[model samples]
Target: MDISRRDFFKVAGSTVIGAAAYSIAGGFGSALAQAPVVGSTQITNGIQSVGSKAKVYFTKHIDAAHLIKLYDLINEGIYGKVAIKLHTGEKNGPNIIPRDMAKAFWQHVPNSSIVETNTLYKGDRYTTEGHKETLKVNGWTFCPVDIMDEYGNVMLPVRGGRHFKEMSLGKNIVNYDAMVVLTHFKGHAMGGYGGSMKNIAIGCADAKIGKKMVHGVPLDKELDEAWDVVYKQDMLMETMAESAKATIDYFGKHIVFLNVMRRMSVDCDCAGTSAAEPTIPDIGILASTDILAIDQASVDLVYASPHNKDLVERIESRHGLHQLAAMHDLKMGNDKYELISID
Candidate 1:
């Protein structure tokens, strides 16, 4: 039988509470204290904390069964007109998060709408009309889909950035009182990996100025030239970190993050038709209040996995891990985190 979203949550709520209690009672907290450290870094309960790591929750189940429960765990302090930010995937893209899973999550969130920005590259999501058409094709009709950049852009202050003074984002982003960053964890042709940071910086930014700012290119610059201009890999990573930090600052404590580690592809959802298949197996879903911790934890899990050679190579070749250090420098959140398994 197909489980309804409400039904999924009922069981998931119980399972999450039970599992969390069991894990806590099993000396998981003590293990974190006793866990050996390598220079103030410790890996305990599936966590690798920087200086006392943030808490990241994980579950092996990939479906709504796990996501709904994981959602409950990290959803604290999130209220008021919520914006569930995520990639609706491109038309014909098979690796994006399943709509059914999103449907389940929507049931648990009140007054929330799925929000996204148009793409920079020419594709189905390059323009508002085209993007809306693609949303239907991608099966995202279960909830309200807001194309943030459709109306116009807004200037978000980038307080401490090397390349940009301000970021251009969808003006309507300010409409939401809280944000839920729902990211599909995967590889990218450029960044090597796309998770919370990429999703916020690239995914949240307006297509024109915001994306160009991160790419270190001019708004009128051609796509071909844009890549060449930002060839300094660390610049791209740092700029992405800066843009992400700006978005984070805008929301303050009114944001939470979730990364679905299914469809472990070597390409981001933005690649659309060109995205490669999963060379690594589906890890699971993770949620955390800290952006850096969640992103760092995701990378740690991938590296710890036995089947991470391909993804690892992709990340290293593109110097994607540098984003973590850049984010650390930004003091976005702790790279160290305790990975609490709610399974």
Candidate 2:
């Protein structure tokens, strides 16, 4: 049950009073109390989706003009240099955003760069050169990660994100006048589904920092003495959460979050070798300035689908993924936000 922002406080106050009244005089009054109102906006952050434009589009019939959707919120001079962060897929993975999509999206923006960094795990994806070679072999030679023409420049660096006092590739990304993040919305083995936060946070950070982001602390503090597979998972979660915070801090306010829910995958593009079909049907696209709101909406839709309940169940059972709970705890973003609908 969800309530709109305007009615949240009223509902909350009434809820408290009703609970007390029930304790004093239990009866129909309790039953009559606010029955978890459906669609009651609960997350009380500055992000009220009210009066804001959601701007939902899809590629069901017509291929979406994603950049035009961006143009809706963007105004001239609002930004000069824009950084386009996307997943170029992992070692053996496919379904990295299609090259055609890249050509279409990157071509639209002015002074934009196609950006990606390395990974922490010792693999072929560890170095820029190795990653580049992987992309070419994977049929990504046409659309490269860092390609600079007269209009825009793309780059990758050694260290990135807020975790470090100074990123080796510092200021180049941070110094950007404006940022636009394009994420292929999909489920993640780690964080349930890699939404805007995961896409930008881990995806934007260079390989060194990306590794740090995935190495979360052990879930069991006692496990410190026991660093096995159990400990590894915990550390990765911490990395996702910690590195996620960096992604949010750096780009949350300055960037726009966009997703193409078509051809959703259970794992991120990084899982290059294995292929898992999307658990659910395509839901189209969503764009938002508020990262949390968009993610919340994304989760809402995912959890709503009967085919995808496994994710929700797994998240709840394993790491409390219903809302990517750690994100709020780590202060990357909140689950509650104001979702204003635009055309």
Candidate 3:
């Protein structure tokens, strides 16, 4: 059951309650880890407040004007060296957000550069060189693409949670004054769904250690030994919420999010060549200052879609709603957001 944010934190108290970890295949063991929570009007650090409904701007045009319009709605407060964080689709991956679609926005933001990190798994993006190669192949050269982890790694503290003390992130993340989370909304092999939360949590973390930590892979274990160990789904999802919360805390109010609902695939761009064909039609683009609000709105739209049977089944089978519920537990954003269409 979904609880109120005030009640959630109140119940959690100062005690860090560690719930029993269960295998993903055994079903979402306890809703305790992924329980839902309502938003509060009172202002809180690293969380949104606009009554109960967070203002999520949307546009169905998907053209340059609509893109810029949605961006302008919440583009304030971002200044200095800005990092436009996004996924440059994997080699042979066709579901990623196109560079051309974002060209106008890229040009509008001064001193902004595209940023990303190497992947945890071995593939085109496993190494900096290979990742850059795929970036060129995928036509993301409109701006300088910085492979964030190439510099090194750093730790950011995850506040008010039942996880590790700190989350490991790419060292280069601190180099920028602000960030724009550009996410390609889609299904995932794990985590049930991918949106702004996953973009910053896994996308901003360094390939090896940071990614492993979010996956619940032991620090001492190598990549090969870690995969099998990190398969406990809810724990990993909870860790992702913690990591995303840490990232939001690190950047504070200087970060904003935009999610392109095009190419509605049941697999993440990270899946690359093995991704399944998209059955759900495009749902347009959404932008928001609230990470949880935007992601929640997107998932709700999918649930309401008549053509989303395949995507819905994919999400349900993977128990993906747990990610949102976990984010709610962390007070990341409001699940009940008022979506404003600019069509």
Candidate 4:
């Protein structure tokens, strides 16, 4: 039987309550605390302290070599059929993480595969076959690239979420015991900035059903009209946070995050070759076991740079900071983080 989104939620209701209660019992916070902080430095630049801070490692050098070095710092819990979740980008997308860098990083991780999901909008990667071809065109051929939703979808409980009780993800997601979220930090059309959260929230969901839920499109509505629907920006951001929480909850302590701040445009890689040219100089690569901390640190770095005007404008205009706030409210990770530089 093809289960509808509403039906999936209905069937998973009891499990959702149990998961939410577990989250309330400090599961998320406790899991976050398991990652030991390597070192700390004095906080600066008016970035306020809130509770205990997570550690975000930064290196100004952006290259394949540094990526592998960064990954080793926080690779403790990532194991067993690891999924390297990253945006492979659209066909010939200029601003994506360089394929050489990705290939090198993939080689560093034992038993890993590059993972992605089909796009909600029509494009070269809108279908499984097309997505495969696009992957080759983008030079992602050196490793196994899993299109997670190629078969079907599965519902995962969303803990501590106001917008969702459960989220639909690619069914094959369960095959992985751990995840490494490698993101290309950049401007996004709707969520302000696309970070680790945006990468998994939109990237992990099943193309048709899960994406419609995240975008607040009624399941009965035509999928082709997704862009035409009117939805609150904050609501969309909150839903994204909720979706990300589901993935984090499912993986528990077995996930890590890294964001590459090179070639950042005021547009997402989904814009393909048409993305606005980046004016902000390349920042660095940031890695952490903390998703919120990594993204928060990335945003802080951008704000600290003098060339941040355009990207900042794009993020603020779309209410993108709300994504971080929502994740904080969900107890996904600490917004306050100690930035440790390895330059």
Question: TM-scores of the models, in the given order?
Answer: 0.85, 0.65, 0.84, 0.89
Maximum-TM-score candidate: 4
The number of clashing residue pairs in each candidate reads 6, 31, 0, 0
Write down the TM-score for model 3.
0.84
Better of 2 and 4 by TM-score: 4
- lDDT of candidates 1 onward, in order: 0.77, 0.50, 0.75, 0.84
lDDT of 1 by residue, 223-341 (tens): 66666676478878988987887677777777889999998789888778788888898899998888888999899889988788989999999999999998877778877677777
User: For model 4, what is the C-alpha lDDT against the true structure?
Assistant: 0.84
| Candidate numbers sorted by lDDT from highest down | 4, 1, 3, 2
- How do the candidates rank by TM-score, highest first? 4, 1, 3, 2
C-alpha positional error of residue 163 in candidate 4 after TM-score superposition, expressed in Å = 1.1
lDDT of 3 by residue, 278-300 (tens): 98889889988888888988898
lDDT for 186 (candidate 4) = 97
Per-residue CA lDDT of model 2 for 18-77, tens digit only, reads 121111111110001110111334333334555423222222321446445543553232
- For model 2, give the 10-residue run with minimal summed lDDT: 28-37
Runs in model 2 deviating more than 4 A are 1-62, 74-78, 139-144, 147-172, 217-239, 317-323, 329-334, 337-343
